[model samples]
Target: MTANLNLYSCDLTDISLSIETILQVVRESKGIDILINNAGIGKFALAEDLELDHWNRVLTLNLTIPFLLTKYVLPHMKRQNFGRLIHITSDADHIGFAEGSLYCASKFGLRGFADSVRQELKGTPITVTTIGPGRVDTFFNGKKPGDRPISLNADDVADQVMHVLSQGQRCEIERIYLKSTFE
Candidate 1:
């Protein structure tokens, strides 16, 4: 039988709700073998002009929620000796843009967190991977014109995820960064 898929669509800014939803999935499902943390939000504003609420919302979803979800899922993954975590980060984590202080901070923190967790999971089948992509044409920050004609598509990221999953248990890819050719 196919494992049950419990999809939770909520404002990821709600930490309590996010944690509760993940806990519910863990409790109801037979087990969780993979987790794809693809949820994130961003705001473009000068660091000085950035609103506190916007920063909090971005950090909560892009950072804390992932950490909490990983914390709750680790036991299941450790028990089964098998798990895959794919974190969707951004190239901005490595570089910086004029109005991306909050976004970059959150993503950078997430990448660091993923790396530390991967190190701690050595010798275990639980794998942690962070995938960073440049200017994907998504409604991530509201729809916009295809500024970069050669920007990576969302499918490109999906293919990366599939590639990671296809790898043997002995292989663990830690990080992948995809950048747009135009930039």
Candidate 2:
């Protein structure tokens, strides 16, 4: 399937480019059955020290990009009455940390966006789910997999994504929170 998969590289931060990317996918695929907004970037800084450009960049990738993608794909989903919108958020969406004001704001906004859109699509086949994981063991922020014992494996979250996708048609998973236990 990798041989048949076509990937288009675009700067998602650029609204025009992002829209074009989505349009291209829709045109090639006929219609979008699922959308996973998994791309994100984090710039950690105290609220007082965060610059406007940094804040805008974080919000653009974490919140605005997802919103735009959803907006573009939603019409097709609504037309077909079937779609799955998945947004990979962070535990920062639920709680704020010392130097994560910008990150938290963007994540929190995404969580809220998922919730509101879910409501709007209620009674439809389309489902909006948010998977918020805590301290995933990835290269995020230059942290390695085993850098923190309390961090979760990337596979852990992938399992949750599969779980959400495997649910029965009658079942609607609104949100899921994942965190690693420190033993």
Residue 146 lDDT (model 2): 78
Q: Clashing residue pairs in candidate 2, if any?
A: none
Task: Indicate the TM-score of model 2.
Answer: 0.92
Ten consecutive residues with minimal summed lDDT in candidate 2?
1-10
Q: Write the per-residue lDDT of candidate 2 for residues 1-183, one digit (tens) a residue.
A: 353556778898897899899888877875677888988899997799989999988899999999999998999998887889999998888899899989999999999999999999989999999999988878888787678757798899999989988987688888899888862
- Looking at candidate 2, what is the lDDT of residue 93? 88
lDDT of 1 by residue, 1-183 (tens): 895667756666788888888888779777789988899999989999998999888999999999998999989888888999999999977888889999999999999999999999999988999999998887778865475457788888999999999999999999999977766
Candidate 2 off by > 4 Å: 1-6
Report the Cα RMSD per candidate: 1.8, 2.2
TM-scores, all models, native as reference = 0.92, 0.92
Q: What are the runs in model 1 whose C-alpha is more than 4 Å off?
A: 1-6, 144-149
Error of 1 at 167 (Å): 0.7
